[model samples]
Target: MVVSSGPLNPKTASYEFNGISGVLGITFGLPLLCVVLNQMIRPDFYIVGLFTNLDIAELWNHIKPLKWYLTNKELWTYYLTWFGVLALFDVLLPGNTIDGVELRDGTKLPYKINGIALTSTLLATLTVRWQLTKGEMPELQYLYENQTDLCIITVIFAFVMAFFLYAASFIPLAHKNGKETRERILSVSGNTGNPVYDWFIGRELNPRLGPLDLKLFCELRPGLLLWFLINVACLHHHYLATGEVNNAILFVTLAQGFYVFDGVLNEEGCLTMMDITTDGFGYMLAFGDLALVPFTYSLQARYLSVSPITLSRPYLAFLSSTMALGYYIFHSANKQKSDFRQGKLPHLKSIDTKRGTKLLCDGWWGISQHMNYFGDWLISLSWCLATGFQTPLTYYYSLYFAALLVHRQQRDEHLCKIKYGDDWHRYESEVPYKIVPYVY
Candidate 1:
């Protein structure tokens, strides 16, 4: 489906957030929550009696010193180097070029689909580095040892990048006639006339550095690849501690690794998602892509590294089946919708919207408006379940993801109602569910 118009000017567009209070809450609350969740994953951090006898002093003692947060020079250098390598690979690797959905400006941005190639190259490079250096590389070990520091640095970097992007958005761009203009260039959506809100939500739809699309690159590359790498580090740490690989860590690593691999392999699919097609690049995306994703999403593997669990044959079978089923549903549902949009499934039933877009009502979509979310949730649950309930923190990803998807589904439905009007009501009437068939 085509976009109705270009990005709304931030100066003139309606506010998306509830108000300054809502914006402040998300901007501050999420990062603080991320830090708390990371700390809660520690093996010694007990949560059983916290509510009954909360100790403010004890909690403060657990927090690292201010100097500690400032002193991870090697970790900082390693992160910057990793980002540079990925950026290099993004520019150097050759892949099929796919055009993104048309924006309000009547132009489609061409995106490079070399994520699989980049993933393969990084793996091969790491392997070579290990063999050549006789496994002397301390970077992975550093990642495991100083995860908290790394997370802090990532959050800091996200803030820096967000500020830079927000500032850059106001700079005048030269037009084809060599005249400068402050008008919306591509599609922008986050201008709320409030600096803090705009910074958190984003001011530019697609921020680029020459040919590199920062949002798309971050969405598919660093956070995801680093998430897989963090899992690898945790697996390696577990082996070092126990002198053998356990099925628990192995399962979590491979399961999440597969998810990341699939995402990178099919990176082009993201071009049609809301992140690429709609949301502006800002602190929200930056923090999510850079900090929350790699650090928090790896909680299962991280927890297993410190507190390993042995899965029985039957339990292993169950978890494996769960993951496989989730993957099948998630992948197939998404593919069906994508195909329908591309007009490859002309036989599918759809509701004709007034805006010339068709609301799909067949196949997986017929089951629910977002069957893929159910599948995705299942996958997350399996990951958490593999951790075996040592601490509730390991389940954070699944819980957070479910809430995020539900909120996103609601937001999307609201937009659809506005865009399609009565047609959306008809479509909803026919489908009769949002994310679960015969349930939600």
Candidate 2:
């Protein structure tokens, strides 16, 4: 068993059966990796040839776009522009540094808040550049065209960055304090004796170089900003390819853009999430945030770029409504929880738990334990609906996301039970459902 410890406990401790997980992980990862590689290299594979009639000439035509992302040096240079600029954006941009959850040491980490400004800067730059271009917009469309290449490069960056963290964890902190401790060098979970597991799962609770935070840079900047850029690129690419942009893709773009906007604007909610609070930075987060999230989550726009699926006004309205509803629930529920945590919301009374933490039983929490997750699922469904029922590939995200959320809810319940014991049961009775209101 792999143990993930809290702030009070050592980051990671060795478990004897480490080989079991290592083997199981390899067994799962290898096949998934192969699929991703195939999706990248073979232009005919991804979401192609499933619904449309096949022709050799069409397949050859599709191969042209793959070359941009598959082999491009210019795309690699943009990484510096993205990371270097975004770092400054985090610093120079508006918003204050807020404290995170109290750690085992009773210290709260400070996170710089300015996701909204950063997003606005990115979108505004893209728009300005598009308008100033000579003939047609080339920068973003080129970026989108070579998106696969950039994603692969970022994956390489993730691995390299993870290795750097692994190495840095062992390096002593500055000698300024005059007292250097090995425990201080490591995160709560990172000292797991096994190198493979430690590298993959990560050992550091939080790793930093001076004031620069590695995890924060990975989580918010590249993947999310790139995801938004890719959506617009898809819209532009479709216009370039067919000379007509489809309504469904536009709706999908707006829907995804809304989610991304909310993610950036309300990033303060991230301070308490598992990524920041409990999980260490390792290959899992490294690849997930850098490569997996941007490319895979935006597959809807990608699919729409090649094959435009036009939806009726009623269908588009339904999609918009579903996404809107999900966003509302997700936002409201999250704010409710955050307000309760930050010691506000006087109108809502909290249920006092034995563990000293308050339970949210009334308002949105009374509907379902993870009301936000249900909303997210609905949003994912709307993305799939925008692609129509052409191929199962488009629906993959929603299917996987649902499973992931259900599993996460179970894990949360388990942890709550361990922490609060009978108090957890009492809280569960009050909140009832895990994710969905009544069905789940």
Kindly provide the TM-score of model 2 when superposed on the true structure, using C-alpha atoms.
0.85
- lDDT tens per residue, model 1, 49-115: 4356445455445567757666867767888998988998998898989898776656687888897
Question: Per the 3 Å backbone cut-off, how many clashing residue pairs does candidate 1 have?
Answer: 3
Model 1 misses residue 328 by how many Å? 0.8
- For residues 1-440, could you state the per-residue lDDT of candidate 2 as single tens digits? 22235544453544322454853475357334523532532345545544464343443443336456446566666876777777777777887788877766556668878877787888788778877885377777667766655765676667777788777666655556768644433444456766766776667777876655677767877788778778888888878778886898888888888787777877887878877776678776778887777777888888887777779989888988888898889888988998887788767856788757788887888889999999889989999989887677778789879988997787577667877888888887777789999987
**Candidate 2, residue 118: how far the Cα is off, in Å:** 1.3
Q: Where in model 2 is the C-alpha error above 4 Å?
A: 1-8, 11-75, 175-191, 346-350
After aligning candidate 2 to the native by TM-score, how far in Å is the CA of 227 from where it should be? 0.9
Error of 2 at 138 (Å): 2.7
Query: What's the TM for model 1?
Result: 0.93
Query: How large is the C-alpha RMSD of every model relative to the true structure?
Result: 2.5, 4.8
